[model samples]
Target: MTGTFKKIRRRVWLILNILVVFWMLAGVLCMQVPPSEFWPAGFVALSLPGALVLNFLFLLYWVFRRSWLLVLPLAALLLGWNYYGRLLAINFAEEVPKEAKTLQVLSFNTHVFNAYDKIVEGVPQVSNDMVDWVATHPADVFCLQEFYSRVNSIEYNNFNRIGTRYGKYKFVSTLETDRIKANLGIVIFSKYPILQGGTIHFLNKQRESANRAAWADLDVNGDTVRIYAVHLQSMSIKSEDIENTYSAIGNEESFKKEGRNVARRLKRGFIARAQQVEQLLEHVRQSPYPAIVCGDFNDIPFSYTYQELAEELENAFVKAGNGVGATYNGPLPFLRIDNQFYSPGLRAVSFETHYEMGLSDHFPISATYVLEPKAAE
Candidate 1:
């Protein structure tokens, strides 16, 4: 009986080892591309775990076995290469800033009117808190997603109160939806003179949900700097999804339903986001000046949108930010979705994620960039 038990244990371990190996290979090879492609779909279909899970398992395996050989290779397969890439990007930013002109940009998703209702009831101080946050940051250029304001509001004067609070800044406000109750949209503010700026309405909504991308041309030392502020399709998994996910931990029916909903949302979100990213890619390709793309992407760092944007520009956070660099304003923030991506000629001098202000569901991200000089135009 003892011999039979030993054989059973050996068989179990062997099967588990094979499964782990297959999992690592699948994640590393075919599905390693940006989440905006076929790979993300494949991952979701397989019901494979996220990077966070794999990371945790990798560390736990080492803890139990005390073996560097197996653990180190797993780490490399999981997240090592991306981390190294981020390091190299930071090194590149550090060296380039010393020799060029600088531009500071801020990106934030105010979460539909400063997340006031989400956090508390009758929070009149929310607007003031937002103004104060911006004043403290003092960015050369600011891009705001979910920048809610009064309906039928026109011109930069509409935001005069907030503008005065931020040292009389100029801005271009786009109407995502013209409703007094919601009053939600995007606004781009600049201390630098705005040569030209406008809205790129992606989804014309009767109900007003999917509003994305704002464009601007700022005069940077007599050169044109194109800026694209974007907010992509959300993960679709809502508050109920979170509740169901937690409740399902012990309850079987709840668990099955929650799992199915999560899988459905993940697949749908990936496909829609990939389409949106492809459009943005086309926009970037057509841009006629040095570009800076900044906003609350709403997706994690590993998603397709982030990687696609990075192809044409350098991510400011990965370039200069340190630590986990999360920007979501919540009880336990574990991801960096707000980002600033700039042209290769631009260099990031300083980058920071402002987390102290409690006005929005997302914290603001700011970065100072240096524009390289040229002999010609």
Candidate 2:
């Protein structure tokens, strides 16, 4: 009877260890493969946090059991240290005096400032709050995604108001949807003079009106720094999709359909973003000046879109931020989709994710950088 119990326990332990091995391999592959090579890997990448947590539990279990199995997860963790660092960091906070040479930049996805809100009584209250926030917390550069404004509409003139409020700064935007009555796109307001600016449109047939990258060449204190404010391919997960996902407990058929829909959307987004990243990287490489890229990437830290960009630029969050800097504020709170990456020539002094204001589905991210003298020259 005791032997039978011991045999059962051993079998369960073996199964658990096998599951850990599978997840660990998947997590490692996520860091190595680009979604361009195999799009399915991107989905695996998204499950990395879950894999990490499970491995941690396994590590604890093996420690208590005084078994040599602890080495499996411990080695996997050590091997994936670079990928883990991008998701979370431990930095001791210290007072770093603001220097005259530092450039402060903020990136935010305003979600049209809740202009289409129905659940909320006041439609534009969030919009008004965001405007007020921008007016007060001024930065050298503001890269905004999903920015919207309606012509002659008092409540929707946020685009004009923001530009007028920051009158001294140069404002550049890509008007993807330029209708007679309204406009929607990405915008960049820079304290420095904008010498040149343009947009890089994705060639996908199913592209959204706001899916594109806008860039500006700013003359910052006699230095020409090119900055790209980009909005990548969205997952297109509608409210109904969220509802279906949550309420799929009882109906098996409905659950399967909803799962397929969500997976299809994600797969499409991954492929489109892969193509977009290649084009954007080409554009960045052609730039004559040092570059700083900021906006809602719509991809997590372990994604191919991030890996490609990180290969060319330095992530501001990984450099100066502390903790899991999750920028996406939604049902899934652990997603840090919005990001800021700068050329190696700039040093990130500070990085912050603002979550206090619930104006949009994304938390605003800001980073201060000091340009190296040689790069500035």
Per-candidate TM-scores read 0.78, 0.89
Candidate 2 segments exceeding 4 Å error: 1-15, 30-37, 94-100, 118-126, 153-155, 176-180, 205-210, 375-377
The global C-alpha lDDT for each of the candidates, from Candidate 1 onward, is: 0.65, 0.80
Model 1, 1-377: lDDT tens digits are: 99999678756654565565565455444334545447354353233334335544655765676655455436545554663344223333355535467788888887654444533443222365675566566678878787765433332123554555565445555654422333456777777677777665554222333657878888876877888888877766666677768878988987988898887787766666666766777887887888888887766655555656766678888778776677876543466778888875677777887877656778888888877775585
Task: Mark the 10 consecutive residues where model 1 has the least summed lDDT.
Answer: 149-158
TM-score of 2: 0.89
What is candidate 1's CA lDDT for residue 91?
38
